[model samples]
Target: MSGSGSIITVLDMFGARLPGDLAFSLSQCGSISADHPLAGEIAAALGGKAASLPYPRRQDFMWVTLAPTAEQLRCVIEDLRCWVLPSFGWESSPPIVSDGGPAGRMGALLLAQSPQGYFRWHSRPADTDHVIARLATMRAVIAQAPARLSQLRPTLEMLRRQFTLGLATGDRDMALQAIDEIDQRQLDTASNALSMSIRVAAAFGDDQAIVDHPQLDNLLSMRVPQRVIESVLLAHHAVFLADLEAAGDIKAALAAYLPLHDRLSGLAGHPADDADTGIVRMAAYDAALAEDARRLHLLADRFAGDTVVAALVASPPPIAPLPILEPAGQPAPETEAQSVEPAFGEPLQPSVAELETVRVAPVAVTAEPALPLGWSDVPALVATSAREPLAALLQHAALMPDACDPGDGDFLIELLTDSEIIADTKKRAQADQVLTTVIDAYVCEERFPRRERLGLYETVLDIWSSSRALSTDPIDGQLLLTMADALLRLNGHLEAAVATMITRWWEARPVRSRLAWLGEALELLTEQSSAQDYLGLWYAGAGLINVDHEGFSVADRYLWYRLGRRLGLDGTATDEALGVDWLPLHSADDPLLAAGFRKIAIVSLHERAAREAAAQIEDRTQAHVVLVTDHAAGEGTASAATADVILFVWGAAKHAVYRAFDKVRDRLEYVQGTGSASIVRALERRVRAAGG
Candidate 1:
């Protein structure tokens, strides 16, 4: 064979016929001697005299110019083990060649071929060192090569093969190195890598390898093939139990084994899907199942006195085989040249340029008006007359409560506290008259229901608190306090609105009187209220404590203790709630205690806050927490849809940002606060409310 682009031209000048003997030699040896009868025929094909022509060596030239018959090409390929390409009269444009002989050329060809071909060739037994060296060379080539669509599948295959061979030969360093490389590459083959790693780790009986693998969490978080996950987890557990048993730690071994036994027993009773129909392609999977069964039998014999294990061992779940997926086909080329031959008499379709010239009428679109950022900007019903404007507004509100806009409450409060109205004696008198009229209508049993009155109370609290008024007038303070008391008593459920309003009211109160008022409000809470209500009240009180500004004071501690007792919690809960190092309340019967959600996706724009929240929830509940910091990112929608519960940090996220999770709205719960403690509290309340 020759190097790239080398060609040897041959021409049939004499066109002499070959005799039977020379034909047989040509067929057998794939060559002819200069003295043979057909040598002149071969020489003539090279456009040379027989005696003057030099004999060609098989390895000397990359491409021979002779036009060989089909039989001769077959002889060269089968007998000589050389690849032969018959030029279809296109010698002037031969295929691109790599630098090497037939075998090297063949290897390069395999590399350029589809992923399936590459994998098939590399999987064959070879010198381990040679394979590794070749892989290293290929890595460099791949790294330097322009990233083409055609190279993706083949590259993934190469990495996978490296990982496989490394593990097979007990070169853990090599295996781990391959894994590290895969991570560094940041390709879309993470699932494949995870699956391969899990299988190899299980096969090698290295439970720690699987358990401690960096990608283990990813394997758990991602939606890999169900059969693969189940099989790998089972194998991992079995290996761990075996190791424990061997070390004479029977108790630890039993603790690990019993749960798996119970799970299998439950699965046996349920028998989800057809166990007979499920088939896995991995021999290691089948081996793991058998090994686990044997281990379980051994455990049953060793711990014969244990009724639970005996019962579980008596009937085991059938190990279902899952069908193995075939290797994925190579992706289609990104672009392909197509030659379009026009039909003899067919009319041509309009070209893109021609179509672009044709104009289409624009369709009218009626877009919905955007909502205002704050309630103050929204338009509300205007008073019919400028005179007695406050009174007219109140009258209209009372008459049309159902038709009243959300901004009406804000507008009403604006009029009540307007500087011009409050400063002017006559205007203040008119505002007071309208305010009394509205309060009377609000408090009336027949006119405003309890829910409507609660809403009005929340509106007043929100507006007044946001105004940051420093009015020390006894009547003004008392009026707000009285409304807060009524709102708390009237609201049966734990509403976020109530919590927010209470917090705001506490924040707006005089510093000297705030704690006293909050303590009295806490005292007024009835035992009939849910723990959620108590927590909501505590959240409001805690908002005003400002432990970060001033160290946890005696009064703050006492307040937290009081709030804790109301929630049926102890001093530990109080301590946690009071300090920065907080822990979620745990009890044997607490709904959030051991709440086994597989995943909880927390979506927030605040990265640090989201991470803190995830850490707290994960620690408390022992559940996987997928922190989606950017709502618009790739994983947000998937996490939202897959998580058992989605805790959206309402305060940290924007309205438009969270619309991506609209499809999973039913699973979504708006967390009222962004702090870790608040997120954990929200999770607890949500779990309790769902009776989890």
Candidate 2:
């Protein structure tokens, strides 16, 4: 019999009858997937005549029949208790029991009338308590679903509204926040066009960030919001005018601003919609644009007759003087201990007679008219008559171009080293001025190839090293360092500078901290990781200056590892030197780390060798055939091979066949020397026997 738990006594008065259609309908059962087994079971329990049904089609008010046996009734109640009721709590939709009276639909309310009310249903049938308890539990989940949906709806709507307002008001911060929220919630389900436009505006607003961002054009071409597109177009002209005004170019500022003002005025004419706030914003923008234009025009009129403005319009700005940065990590001025010694390897004292005779300017030389020598002949002449050789070279140098070729560079080296010329302060000063001119020419030539430029620097340093007075004039030293910094910035070989600094300029050099020099060196490694090996050479130079220099510290090791990490090297011992240590070590004590560091250092030398070999291969334009040998160390039989050029390694394998050849030769030579004539003949017979 169908019965309510609250009215067990009144159920018999209504009129009891045989259980002809023992059935109950549950609305919450609709949420199950169509393929779920529970759907078929519910249909079977209703009656044998019931047809199979899928979820939600008939399960929304699914009615199931109770079997006649108590065991069968228990089985039907158990399925509802274990499977169907729990599913309703997890489903996104709310659940409710149906097809009973309106009073039965309020089943959870009737069950809650007494907390221990399950005993009220015990008189009805076997295991009825289990069914009552499950129904009550399912009712609780249905009640909570509506409350959860209410909370989520408002937050999502607020974020969407904030994003829309941000676009309308041109507020980058608010727009970014909305974008972040939308991403976190996965609410921007359709298009990210508005989000992308906001990011572009934020990037463009920052002067420093925009300088290197090459994607402004790409962003503009994307499917961004129309309002964002309009704003950016106006902002571009505003930025240009602001830049010109900052540079003191009043005419250019006026030219850039007036067009911007016209664009804004044109926009204000086409009001977006009556409800749209864009028209009001355009009016505000118009006012701002007009003010900027008026200010720029006024400034242009005020400077109308200024001579500086007239001169600026005619030509570009003059080159600014190179600013001298204080030696890295050195806060204090140079002390007596750090001051440079005298030039020409001599004492600070100069005699009155010496001072009088030393002319700082060049003196006129009478024409002697000796046999003219070639650039190659200067080195040979210097070996014979040193004084006459240098004087002759300087005279030849005077007739050469401002930018010296390798030949002129060779002659200049001879002049710089000539003792007689250096002894005469005027001639030494004159040669220095010539040296200055040569370096300036190197700097000014935009099209000079890297190899030729590198050779020029090496030649100059070699010449400077040859001089007995190794002390560089302060101005000349600064010029060399400046040239080095510039060459390095252009990704040119700066190892020559490192070599020059170590060999010629080390004694009186003002490089205070090796760490600071390393930081400068890292900037030059933009294109390749091969430059990292040069740091070891730098450390070697710094080591000579101190027993315990910065290179020996754990901080230096960490810096090296950090650089490797930036290159995306794995933390293998050979690559990362045992990873970065945050704490500085007193000394690099780990032997494994040290070995890996040494391995890391050899990259630069290997890269340089490979580059040179490639260059040699490229230079052979006329040769019909090219033969490269791994045996060529620029010496021995490999150099004499009748081929275009000899590379130290070749082929896809990059095989060093020379090393194997040397090993075999060593064994053959040992056998040849140790054997008697008869034994040698026997060995040669055996060698021929093996070959045949």
List where candidate 1 sits over 4 angstroms from the true fold: 1-463, 466-589, 631-633, 656-659
- In model 1, which residue pairs have backbone atoms overlapping below 3 Å? 1-59, 2-61, 2-62, 11-45, 278-321, 278-322, 279-321, 279-322, 279-323, 280-322
lDDT by residue (64-104, candidate 2, tens digit) is 22232323444444544464444432221222222232345
Model 2 vs. true fold: TM: 0.22
lDDT of each: 0.43, 0.35
Report clashes for each candidate as comma-separated counts: 10, 1
Span of 10 residues, lowest total lDDT, candidate 1: 114-123
TM of each candidate vs. truth: 0.26, 0.22
Q: For model 1, how does the per-residue alpha-carbon lDDT over 413-515 read when each residue is reduced to its tens digit?
A: 7765567666767555455444444443343212122554466667756564554346543333434444554555467463445455545665565353454
